[model samples]
Target: MKFQNIFVLFFAVSMFFSTQNIAAQSDEVVINEIMYKSLKAFDTNDWIELYNPSDADLNISGWLLKDDKDTRHFAFPANTIIKKRDFLVIIESKNKFTNVHPGIENYVGSFTFGFGTDDMVRIYNSNLQIVDSVNYKSKSPWYPETDSLGPSLELISHELDNSKAQSWRPSYVMHGTPGRPNSATHTEDEGIDDMLLNVFPNPAISSINIEFDTQVDGDLLIEVYDVLGNKVKTILENYMQSGYYNSYWDGLDESGNPTPTGIYFIKVKSPNGILNTKIVKSN
Candidate 1:
């Protein structure tokens, strides 16, 4: 009986320590999204996103993000409160991305560090203790296109791991849903690739055609923006069924005036996802 009591006590102690270790492993604020490459050009803008999983706010003040080599380290400002279940986006270039995703400007912070195709990102607390880390990849099973002109790699769910390749997915949006909900954080298995878009006659003289194929149905907002990021026109803003669709732009602005010949972006957004591509209008 004494042996039994001792065994029970030992087991209880072991369980307590195990639970404490598990709790320490789980981060309240985790790395949720990584946009290491920008569409149209790889060197455009890069960013990382963090999400607070806890019900209460997590103060990431003085948190440092460093690479595996420890060569680069970017620190967060003091009193950086990532609201409960909210996201914090750190971009490499605020000026470059603000034009595209003006909506997320308020949540944006600037970082000058670079995250390699296959690299380690470690987050340390104010005490310089490791909070969380993820070593991402640029190979298959991880979506290689994200290293080039593809979507940003987003964590599917906070329940999943931030370090695993399967836990990450490509952002359907051009730059990414930085400072906002991630595209991969969906319960449905239907992914961002359910819809595909292709723009031809990129540098068209008069008119340009935007064609896309969809495997799912949802409401979408399609708009055209010039090089200056001005909303020249809105092509479509309504529900669309699963099928191939086309949007024709006749080189005209919203006021029915001729638009100047320049580079423009075509953005197609839906509750499920978003897609963006560039087109050039030449005289």
Candidate 2:
């Protein structure tokens, strides 16, 4: 082969790889959460949260966030940086958003939803290239309950496919955790044991059921905390065999008596991370 032809082939190969690298970089920023329908009186502003899943800082300045119908549009600020694994919240109205969350100033407001419950949101880079697009509806796949309820639909894993409804879930709290990690965000740190705790009959009249799954063998600790962060009950503290297990809390504290009403937190500490959920006790 001629040297000139070889050089031409090399140049073309490098350009192809360069374009692929740019496309991958643009896709690192993902749509992390959406609050199309909000129910909180104090937080009436609907918002969408973006996340940088890549290890490098992503400059999303001048990027376009628009709905499929071209109704809602948002152009990001110049040189806006989404740090590595960080979150940026773009809201519909700044006044309503800041009115509720004053400390979180990392929000871009002044955009309104142009379509109804079912619509698509697209994110495009400065060169008008598609980064990511999410088509969300008020039906299956997406959380249907969040369509009218207070909680927002939060992406479970940005590393997962966002176009699927199974990738999202209704936030555990109302209005969602804007400008922060989603309530359903799972810890992917593999250094520790992975665990999940589920408590049913939250507003229990007498007893409650606690089920948990463990991925690693470790000392498992189960405790109950009041809304004030006071340790109310110690359910278990033993070296557990990893897999799946169940425990019961008869609405009793460490003293073997009934607990009070209101809200209580069930905390399960494992090697992976801490698992927390709420259970309401009523008389």
Candidate 3:
């Protein structure tokens, strides 16, 4: 009788830790790398790479990628699985990605979704619980080169905190090393004059502040675009001397109505270059 009780207690303890480990593995699936801004010269669209660092296969069937404001989501097909310590890429256009790199089988998604120069990428499980998320930018602190024909952003190491901008760097090669271990180890450019774009209180409820500095005097154009690429608000468009400038957005459209809660892109065009950042409006 004593042996039976001891066995039951041991089994219970093992199951408890086993359940905890599985939960940890689910959260371990990280947004490894992002190729948000594809080179204009290349025909490929945006793609996001994911890494599974757990010791067991993860059946991510029904998992989905949520975009700004949940405007659109791409759910994983039935029976989709990512093996232990493997890589999978979610592509915007499967045909385009395949045409460039053939035989790379660990990929999914051809959703009509596109990532902006500055955008957010989020993943959720079947239960609608967030698994992992990453917000990337196209300006300094971020790899400015990634804004256009530059290399894709690669996480320095999967063990690092990917939520921080400093944890990422531009891929050494153009496009990026998708479905493979990252080999990018380049130093951040210190000589370049960054625009220093700053958007405050992301996921803003009522308003947001945009602050930036211009190195040269020229025409500055700032506009807000909805998820569908519609011009919702024109924040500023004026000729200003090279200096620091601050602007505000009251979450209203051209018609003076409250903008819908969703993802919005703030585009700032200055003499230096075009700086794009993302802002989320919440109810």
The candidate maximizing TM-score is 2
Please give the distance, in angstroms, between residue 64's alpha carbon in candidate 2 and its true position after superposition. Answer: 0.9
Please identify model 1 stretches exceeding 4 Å from their true place.
1-26, 41-44, 106-108, 187-283
In the order shown, the candidates' Cα RMSDs to the true structure are: 9.5, 7.8, 14.7
Cα RMSD of predicted structure 1? 9.5
Q: Write the per-residue lDDT of candidate 1 for residues 1-283, one digit (tens) a residue.
A: 9999999999999998754422232357788888776666534477788888776657777878887767688888866777777888877787777777777753546777777888887888878888878888888677665776556888888888777888887765556788888866642343357777777897799988888787777887879976444689998888889898988888899999999876677877766676666676888
Whole-model Cα lDDT of every candidate shown, in order: 0.75, 0.77, 0.79
Lowest lDDT 10-residue stretch of candidate 1: 18-27
How far residue 223's Cα lies from its native spot in candidate 1, in Å, is 19
Per-structure clash totals for the candidates: 0, 3, 0
Ranking by lDDT: 3, 2, 1
Model 2: residues >4 Å from true position, as ranges?
A: 1-25, 187-283
lDDT of 3 by residue, 1-283 (tens): 9999999999999998765433322777889888887766665688888998888778788998976759788999986778889999999887778876676889998777888877889999988899988887888688766666546889987888898998997665557878888745432222126466789998799999998787777888889986445799999999988788899999999999998887677878777566656677888
What TM-score would you give candidate 2 relative to the actual structure?
Answer: 0.62
Candidates in order, TM-scores: namely 0.57, 0.62, 0.57
Per-residue C-alpha lDDT of model 2 across residues 1-283, encoded as one tens digit per residue: 6999999999999998754423234668899988887765665567888998777677787888988865457898876778778898888888887876778877776675643479887898888788888899988656565665566788888888999998887776566788888877752232234776678886788888999888788899888877445799898999988798989888888888878775676777887677667566778
Q: Looking at candidate 2, what is the lDDT of residue 8? A: 98
lDDT of 3 at 249: 93
